[model samples]
Target: MEKTLVLIKPDAFEAHHVGDIIKMYEGIGLRIAAMKLLQMDERLASIHYAEHIGRPYYEPLVSFMTSGPIVAMVLMGEDAIHRVRELHGKTNPAEAADGTIRKLYATDGRKNAVHASDSPESANREIHIFFNETEIYD
Candidate 1:
């Protein structure tokens, strides 16, 4: 089985939609191996989004992420990385499919309601960033 990192962003938490979001993932047969609610720190957010460091939205992205508590989780399943991203839909809600999580809950690109690691390497890296090995129990 593959593993992926999933983040239910602050907006979801603030809006009280965490249960509904988690239910959507569970409905897809994704197993939650580890999870937590955390208020992201600037340093951690910077490291997590290192590739976007030079992008114009980098600063704002980081600030937005740290603005409230977020739900971080590690999901395990077959083709988990790609599967979770598909479940989240496109980065921009306006372009996401009608049935996608973002399309249903997100208001825009910058305030997209969720994040999923794009690859196995990124999944592993992001999983470690938020969870210890033991935390991801079978």
Candidate 2:
């Protein structure tokens, strides 16, 4: 089975959409290998978004991420990385499809409700950032 990382961002968490989002994933047959609710600090945020460092939007992105608690999850299934991204929809909610998570919950492009690893390598790296070997379940 493949595993992917998904984050219910601060905006979505603050709006209390955590269960609804998880339900969407589960509805597609993805299993939760691990999950947590935590407040992201700058250090963690920087590490998670390392590639985006020095970009124009990096600072604000980090700031928003650290602003509140987030739900971090490791979802397992076939083609999990791609599946999660499809469920998450476009980065801009206005451009997302009608049934996508972003279309249903996002407030704006930046606060677009969710984040998912875009590739297999990204899924592995991101899952490690929030979960260790002991945290994941079969």
Candidate 3:
């Protein structure tokens, strides 16, 4: 099974949508291999979003991420990365499809409800960032 990382952002966590989000993924047959709630510090955020460092949205994104606690989970299933990203929908809620997580819970593009690894490489990299082998389960 492929493993991907999903982040229930601060906005969604604070809005009490974490249960609904997890249910949605579970309903789609994704299994949670590992999970945790954490408050991302600046260093972590910087490391997580290193590619976006010079972009205009970088600073705001980091600030928002560090503003509250977030749930980071490792979900395992066939095509997990693609599946998670599809469910997450477009970054802008206004542009997301109906029934998608972002469409249902995001306040805006910047505060989109969740973040998922976009590819196998990203998934592997991100999963390691949040969890070690001992933390995952079959």
Top candidate on TM-score is 2
For every model shown, what is its TM-score relative to the native structure? 0.97, 0.98, 0.98
Clashes of 3: 0
| Residue 12 shift from truth in candidate 2, angstroms | 0.5
Q: Could you give candidate 3's per-residue lDDT for residues 60-136 as a string of tens digits?
A: 99999999999999999998888888999999999999999999999999899899998889988888888999999
User: Candidate 2 overall Cα lDDT vs. reference?
Assistant: 0.95
Candidate 2 weakest ten by summed lDDT: 79-88
RMSD each, Å: 0.8, 0.6, 0.7
| Least accurate 10 contiguous residues by lDDT in model 1 | 78-87
In candidate 1, clashing pairs total 0
Task: List the global CA lDDT of all models.
Answer: 0.91, 0.95, 0.94
lDDT of 2 by residue, 1-138 (tens): 999989999999999999999999999999999999999999999999999999999999999999999999999999888888998889999999999999999999999999999888999899999999899996
Which residue pairs clash in candidate 2? none
* TM-score of predicted structure 3: 0.98
Clashing pairs in 3: none
Give the total clashing residue pairs for model 2. Answer: 0
lDDT of 3: 0.94
